[model samples]
Target chain A: MTNKTPLVELRNMSIAFGGVRAVDDVSVDLYAGEVVGLLGHNGAGKSTLIKMLSGAYGADSGEIFINGEKAKIRNPRDARRYNIETIYQTLALADNLDAASNLFLGRELVTSLGFVDDDAMEAEMRKIMTRLNPNFQKFHEPVSALSGGQRQSVAIARAVYFDAKILIMDEPTAALGPQETQMVSELIKKLKAEGIGIFLISHDIHDVMTLCDRASVMKNGKLVGTVDVDTVTDDELLSMIILGKHPHQKEA
Target chain B: MSTPTTNRSAKTFFNKLGIDLRLLGMIGALVILCVMFDLITGGRFLTPRNLFNLSVQTASVAVMATGMVFVIVTRNIDLSVGSMLGFIGMTVGALQVYYFPDIVGLGHWSIWILASIAAIIMGACLGAVQGWVVGYLTVPAFIVTLGGLLIYRGAMWWVTQGQTVAPLDPTFRLLGGGADGTLGETLSWGGGVVSSLVAVGLILASRRRKANHGFTVKPMWAEGILIALAAGLVLGYVYIMNSYTIAKGALPRIAEARGIELTEGLTLYHGVAIPVIILLVVTIGMTLISTRTRFGRYVYATGGNPEAAELSGINTRMLTVKVFALMGALTGIAAIIASARLGAVDVGLGTLDELRVIAAAVIGGTALAGGFGTIYGAVIGALIMQTLQSGMASVGVDAPLQSIVVGLVLVFAVYIDIVYRRKTGA
Candidate 1:
């Protein structure tokens, strides 16, 4: 991992729904040129914590520091303005549109006459998809007709294409097969090489151990601890997740 | 799975037929229906005069349906279009009769243009209200437009004070699709030739463009065939229109002044109706708007999945309002046609036009569930509908039977769509 300053820091973030804390006082930091794995069980507040940064859900209380400066992200538009992008677990693609349309959904490239420059967009999509997933070629097919892995390519392509500096991906590989996953791992490694930070919300320890430099585990709306993946074995992280107890700190 | 593969298993008979199977199926059905009607009507249905009249008849509904396709594609409906047409027709008629009776033709055509602008503005305002209710206020469109349908119909009656406004200006009536209300023969023939040439040029240009981008496009033979078919249809229309003759006394003054000595039986009353021209223009414009605009993408995306569109930072509500407002403006255009055709406007001006417009869109393969349709499909759908109504009359069918038959056709078309979807596993 690079010994550079953190790209983003979430300090004392909290939000509640219907009088219950979905996420409580979760603090996580992602550094430039590093992959931070957010590991948690379902309903463990990992998704909720990431949602705040993504601008999908505004935190009731928290401060977000980006490049050591306070930032306000009230909605998805604001997040995108900061060059932050998120690939929701759902993929969130319009089913009736072809791959090119879905890739540039809200932000379309149009000619001077204001008509969409579809040919241009498609050509650009081809270039990016070729690099991201060399096998992706369903440029004209609606995402609904595509397989799960193809859909992932579209979602990932959208986030990756638009000069993203901080990417928050939720279960991006859950639906992908091993080959596609490998393709994605390569893409992520390439992005990291370019100095972009990524927060990977994943349930699979194998992926976390292999891809992420550091792992931050959360349980019952609180952080167990953050540890270097090379320092802890899979069992140690598993215990941290299940027991909500840090490896170095004894339970209260 | 990175490679794009044609799903061989899903390639049914229709898939083998063309890229857009549903559209081809619709055209095939249209051909079959035309042939059946012609045969049953003792060949009267295919007569040039009848076909010409059918084109004029299809104009107003086709115009509205083109707009309706956009609305339906966005998962919304505009049931108020019929009433809105009637209201605007009456309003425009009232303006011609009561406010601008002194204004006549040609040099003073500016009045007509101004009136048209006013009517379009009014229609848009009306549509914006309903769109706002449905899109912003979160009221269901079905309910809002249903209310609009009734309210505007009543407004039509109230505005004209329960009286029919008649005897619109001669120049104004030309916009209604009358025999004298259209392009001159030479102009009509010229338009056909030019448009056919344009079609060829556009096709070739698009092909060249696709090649430049190294994108896959239709084969040369396929492109040739499409261009041939389009040119054939356009030229054929011109040939038929150039043959129709009007009575000498009924001929316009310009033709009489041209000093061409007519042979014993040769006074041409034939030309393309202005309304038909308007329909063509609307079809082309709507086609471009629906296929090549950011607004078009939003409409489709909003219909396909609202939640996904919302998360993608699209203001779906604003898009909905814009679509409905556009629909309203097209309805105004239809209003001009209906009012001009009748030489008057009244409460009955556009009665039941909404049904025909919606049916046209649905029949043309636009899914009521949204996210799938084409403007050209809706136009053809309108043509199919008008052909059925006209053909039934030619066959001496009773009015009740005509109604039942058209109703059945609507349902049958939708059923075919459902079956086709299932067959293709779409």
Candidate 2:
């Protein structure tokens, strides 16, 4: 891979929630337009690290740099200003709102009269969906009626709608079927082509190997290491997470 | 896809009969009551004047009920609306007595404007305090607003010393009554002409806009029929007003009174009052806000899932506070109307008004759990309640019986809502 300045650099970031150090001294670099898979077991601090980037939690120590500049993200609003968006495992979509409405959510497209311009929003949503996920067509219906993959699309659309450059996806395809998983994989590829950095946290090595350009492993709130996906196998990454050491590094 | 298809089919069926079934059921009950009363009283209960009286009578509560929809939709109850109304009305009343004479020696429109602004601001401040407690401090909305109810009403008691303050300026009286008279005034010929034209234009414009937006507009035939019916109602009202004699040969019929008396014809009570008009305008404005605005979307989203909304970068607490503040302001407006109607402000001005407003909203199909309601629905709900109360009183029904009937109706409405929700699984 060509060397480029990382889009997001988390340096020695630590977050503790009531005596529990969810993320401790984790430093990670995410490049522009790259998919970096974060592999970890349950409570391995991957989610907490991502949450810090998404402004769900404030870092107790260390710093977060966006586009090579030190950033202070106090809340989700600040995170959005830094073009960092997160889609949690729950997706955080309003079920009653339709796809177009949910995509705009709090920041809706309004007409000159200050009323929500549903037509303009629908048109924009159609364009985005067509470009990203062609299979997603339920526009008028609420997101609650959408399939798992479609709901994920809506969540992604919401982040992307706000011009999010760095996306933190928390197990986006955790509960999807085979077809849905494929759809999400294709969506990830599209996002990569759009030059948006994605930090994908998942337990599925197959997904990481199939979708990620690089994979990072974390164990017990500490980073094991980052490795190129092309040079490693699923078993190698699994061993990295479980054993907390690279096979080659041990020999070295 | 298959599930939604089947669900849509079921929804269509329900729409055919059960859509607005609450309103229909209420109307049916009202008709039954009228028939029973007519049978018992030998048709005195079936008079046109009584029906007209019912419309004017239910106006204030109906207005407050519309505001209550906003409060209830957010899954919060505003028990303080009634008290806020009393407080604002008394404030306005006190301003007319004390503040107005000291400033411009009364009879100035600016004084009324200032008084209204002061009352509304005071109500909003009170509401903001409650909203801050409920939204920021995480206090329960019910307890906060309930405390608000007691505190505001107590303030009202202290302000007026538990006595009725009256002799309100004529301008204030016009707010409750009309420009010309009391509560029985039907539209004059000129008013009838203007109202009919405005109604038709509004209906057509709305239909066209809906169609342009790809929304299903009601059939043109249905719209035309509705417009025709409205015109007929206006014409009939004009006829009734022209024919009625206030006092035998009280004055000579003037030029304006020839076709349909403008000056000496029917009193202002013969037509829609200013307060009724205010209620309609507020209801329409609020309905538009709820259905069309970005803030309205946030209101729905915040109620639907607070965590999701917050995660989506919405200021959920701020929206809650804004809504609560709006409810308070509306309550103040309602207080002004109520005070005008009663011609005085006292401690009992807004007592039990909150219960009535809440019951109206609940009966109108707003869930106490939040995220599902409309201002129109709430108004209809209030009208149903008011109709029941007025009709019962006309039949000489006792207060205890009235209470029992209202409570039963509330339970029945809620039960229907639960069953409908279960059946639809929405």
Candidate 3:
């Protein structure tokens, strides 16, 4: 997988707010069909770093490359144009609107007369929801009526439907129960098999260990290190996350 | 999945109605108000003549309230609408009566058309300016529109030098519903019949569409009742307006004194006001924008969660600007209607309307917290407000007491809305 150009790469990214380095001197890459776990504690700058690529925030200093091509992501629209989409922890959905509206938020399906083609969008949403979760049936209710897992499914379906090449999911399973967590795990595997790159930011070591092929840990405002999940033990990854040091490099 | 479809033990009034709960709540409130006022006024409040007047009087507020629902839904307040109304009214009024009064005398059709277009453009510009400040400059809307409220009001007063402009062209006054601007008896009947047919057709089409989509719809009996009620409301309004006979009343009295026989049944009901027609168009058009357009959805989304909306590839800042701009243009339309309605423009044209407009939107269910509201609700809110005003005035309530009553009602409506939302967990 490393032999090909990465689907997305962030080189030497840094940003500051009020003279404090929130995300400083970090680098990460997501290859096609790979899930890269961005492991960090609270305020570990994982969100800030990923936001730079998602176009939620601009980097003060960095170079972002997609498909080995230089990119300029000045805004969320720009990021979307590059086929990059982010599912923020909040799911970035309009609670007052039903699944169809939320799914097509900025990109609504409209008739030739310029009116929103609501029925068509609902049909499309039904198709995707069926594909993603066969049990999901609450199509008419506003997303606020949906459960956490159902909302997550809608969010995931939105990204996948948009044909996002680089997907950024923040805390995908942080609030789910065991059943929902399992559903999410299955979805991620399906996405992976479809050859899409994903940056999954998580705090759970167990989740990262089982779901991610590689883990990049961050502490304070900088990267601690990246390690292959097969090569590093759970304790080694935890040590790097909390202590901000690579145990394997120190031992070498 | 465990959530109950309906809480039987805690069956709320809205649940009992069993339609779109939010929509039902608004309709129920409006109906309750009309009934209460009808009882107090000895059935005078629901008289067609009074309802007709009330609807015309509410035209401006209803129009502005349409835009306001969007503004409030986006979690933004436009304090300048009243002042903008005043400013645009004065500006447009000046163009017709003072600046280009002679153009119409030359028999050219450009005065009304040109002036209206210019006023709409001016309104859009003013709104865009405010939107820019709030959206891009990062100034809070409260602060920007607050400043605009003062500045525009001052500007309006200064423009007219506290003097009133009057005698707008006959054609221009049509926009305001001046005597000659009304549809009169024949047209009123015509409009009523046409609208009744259209309303029924719309209801049938909607029912058919729902069925086609395999969507659950209200029972046929309920749907038929709703359609009948809607059509009845339209035709009934026309019948009432046609009852005010003009030819036989004062003209007959003079002819009798002069010993000359006059035509017997020359009735001239105050026909449907032109401004009311304009208000109807605005209502329908805005309903479309609110329910069937991306801009409308984005407004709700932006208000629902600013951060989430932004992350979802929505340009909330630009959406904010557009929402305010649209509000500005509506205010301009309102200004035109208000000034035309009175056949004059003065500094007091839209005085204190900001409070009334916002009150209408809030009463209509647009939450100050944002994310929930409807254009129809706002229009109904305006109607309710107008009904209260007309009802009080007819009963000879003191002006000061009337205002106090209106204020209390506004607060009470909002209180009910909050309590209802809490109980329903909406």
Candidate 2 structure quality by residue, lDDT tens digits, B116-176: 6777787778788888899899898999988888888888878778777877776676666
> Over the stretch A154-229, how does candidate 2's per-residue lDDT look in tens digits?
8877877777799899998886888878877887898899999999999899889988999989998989888999
In model 1, state the lDDT of residue B350: 82
**Which portions of model 3 miss their true places by more than 4 Å?**
B1-18, B102-108, B247-265
Which tens-of-lDDT digit does each residue in A71-153 have in candidate 1?
Answer: 99987778888899889999999998999999999899998989998988998899988887778877877888899999999
Off by over 4 Å in 2: A1-3, A130-138, A243-252, B1-48, B178-269
TM-score of chain B only, all predictions?
0.92, 0.83, 0.88
**Residues B217-237, model 3: lDDT tens digits:** 677777777778789988887
- The global Cα lDDT (0 to 1) of model 1 is 0.87
- Model 2 residue A189 CA deviation (Å) reads 1.2
In model 1, the clashing pairs are: A135-B2
**Sort order, TM-score high to low:** 3, 1, 2
TM-score of each: 0.91, 0.87, 0.93
Model 1: per-residue lDDT, tens digit, B1-426?
Answer: 423344443453334323477877778887887899889877877877887799998999999999899899888888999999999988878887777656564326666776678778988889988999999998999999999999999999998797999877677778887667768688888999999999999889878877888998776777877888889988888788777666567655536544455555656757787999999999988988888898888889988888778778888889989999999999998888888888888678788999999999999988899888889899989999998888888888999999999999999999998898777655
TM-score of 2: 0.87
Q: Cα-based RMSD of the predictions, in order?
A: 4.1, 4.6, 4.1
DockQ of each: 0.62, 0.57, 0.69
